[model samples]
Target: MTKPGRTLLKVQGLTKRFGGLVAVNNMTFDVHEHEVLGLIGPNGSGKTTTMNLISGAFPPSDGSITMNGQRLSGLAAHQIARRGVSRTFQLVRVLPGLSLVDNVVAGAAFGYRKRWGAEAEQFARGLLERIGLGDHMHLPVGSLTYIDQKRLELARALAGEPEVLLLDEWLAGLNPTELQEGIDLIAELRREGRTIILVEHVMDAIRSLCDRCVVMNSGAKIAEGTPRDVLSDPEVIRAYLGDE
Candidate 1:
């Protein structure tokens, strides 16, 4: 088990409003270095919205976000990526026309440290190989299966060598065996001390990966603690299973 270190990301009183609806309300949390923090909730609970705010895909309507004490709330998505934050989308996104290696190379060239030319291509290739896409490096992304595309997206995110990796349901569409493979891959990442914020509906993955969990319902946090504790919390149970 990796012991969590200093606070790496801080989200304080974050809120977002879309017209009359509040997507996230006054949420606050701290993600420690080397920790896998699970953001778990039922559908429509603002989990992805919160992730969007953190990744700069959507700016918060209120409150602040900081990484290692540097303000991140106002930065653009690309700027945030350059500052060591990388993410895979809830829906798989890959460059359909580009070869797998080119897709990852894009990430390496534009990511945090900005590798270029041979260095960038080499780094991208290694990441693809690590993520099990080496044999298909030159193939167009459109030719890959859904799970393989997911793998490519993750590799692209990792190509940046990000300080914090946000995985939004990277395990969503896997079959039983593929799910286990996905889980094991993530476990390896955890062992490598990657700091991650995972927004997922798979309880098994949550239990196996998360050091702690924060549960939300209707865009507001309802519970937080270890997976064992939070999963058993009455309110969290109610949020998922409904009141009886």
Candidate 2:
């Protein structure tokens, strides 16, 4: 059995309802320090809702969220961000008219220490370079391709210098080469000791990056184990991979 280290994030009986629909139901899991946790399931399986709940995109209807032993359930998104959590959204959002670097600078303004002026731009620029957006820094964000826009979202999130990073389908639109580049970038973050929760459909990235994975179905956790184990389970196979 793999031993878990210090708990970085904890969710107990987490549930969210949008009117009559229970989008997430009693989901419970813990993310450990310096480990990548994969949250995977088929489309509409509540993966993104889980990320939103953890990142404070909105309040949960029920359950508790704790980080480093402190309650985080009722905090606003930015307040939660201040507590060392940063996340990339399922839909990449960037200011269309802003220069590429400026979009990241906006994130630095709200994330943690609140960097400003040239210092913020310099820091944001460095992150843009790390995420492979350096050459396009002066261009309007709308000019970038879909894959590059995703990288910009990641750069913005990293500007926060977060301890725990939650990524929701941030690798959606990449080709094979760009996919490998993203996988390498995530590996580097893991090497730097950042705890990550990755919600992705790409099995290759999950296998390469996650030490363990949690499988969800219909808003409930169906299995939890090493990537090989969970992916091979009969239920996981049935729910996801069909009868193959």
Candidate 3:
């Protein structure tokens, strides 16, 4: 676990382009060790593109990504994973045909951080238990509820034991009680001291979990600060919240 205030990940002049469209535009920021940094923006503001760049899903069109003094821009996703960066997709990516435990175990076996063996299986089982899916370990993921699929995604990400975890709208669909449960799970992840970059629309989760926030619009960052401050900013209100 990294201490607060030490820059663990550095993104400088990050930009991404798809043909004529600029998906992300010259955004720069530092994610401190163990900071729950919220990345919020209106739709098409480049939030997901930013996540992809940080996690090496795609190379940047311009600028750099560095984690603890190492350049990460040119690396492949698996290479980046070995470097201790991990993430969950906004659309859950679980293997529907596999048993739940096997789904996590497959990821665990391939991660750059750990060896695949009995020990790894045991670790995967432990993660399922912690994510509240141990009883369903033998069940095919196709039969699981959406919420449980989300939980399985999280557990797969955790199985890699990453230093930085990027969550893309992990709380998009849930009731009030379910939302709080999601919030509590995030709080617990924070307690474990993982550096988190949360790309989410849920304000209550933002206020509850984020130590700081970065807001974007038109593929470029427009405002950044604490949740209370950013949410109240006139520009943010106009760009995202609308006059109310």
RMSD of each: 0.7, 2.0, 1.7
- Give the TM-scores of the predictions, in the order they appear: 0.99, 0.94, 0.96
lDDT of 1 by residue, 111-197 (tens): 898999999988988998898988988677888988899999999999888999999999998999999999999999999999999
What does candidate 3 score in Cα RMSD to the true structure? 1.7
Q: Candidate 2 overall Cα lDDT vs. reference?
A: 0.89
Q: lDDT (CA) for every model shown?
A: 0.93, 0.89, 0.89
lDDT of 3 by residue, 146-219 (tens): 78899999998988888899999999887788788889999899888889999999998998899889999999
Q: Any runs in candidate 2 off by more than 4 Å, and if so which? A: 1-4, 242-244
Task: Output the number of the lDDT-best candidate.
Answer: 1
Q: Itemize residue pairs with steric clashes in candidate 3.
A: none
**TM-score for model 3?**
0.96
**Cα lDDT, model 2, residue 171:** 85
Report residue 44 deviation for candidate 1 (angstroms): 0.3
User: Candidate 2, clashing residue pairs?
Assistant: none
1 or 3, greater by lDDT: 1
lDDT per residue for candidate 2 within 1-244, as digits (tens), equals 2345798899999999999999999999999998899999999999999999889997999999999999889899999998888999888987787888888888888887789999999999899988788898877777788888888888889888887899998888888888888888988888777789999999998988898999999899999989999998999988896777
Model 2 Cα shift for residue 118 (angstroms): 2.3
Model 1 poorest ten-residue lDDT run: 137-146
Evaluate model 1: give its lDDT: 0.93
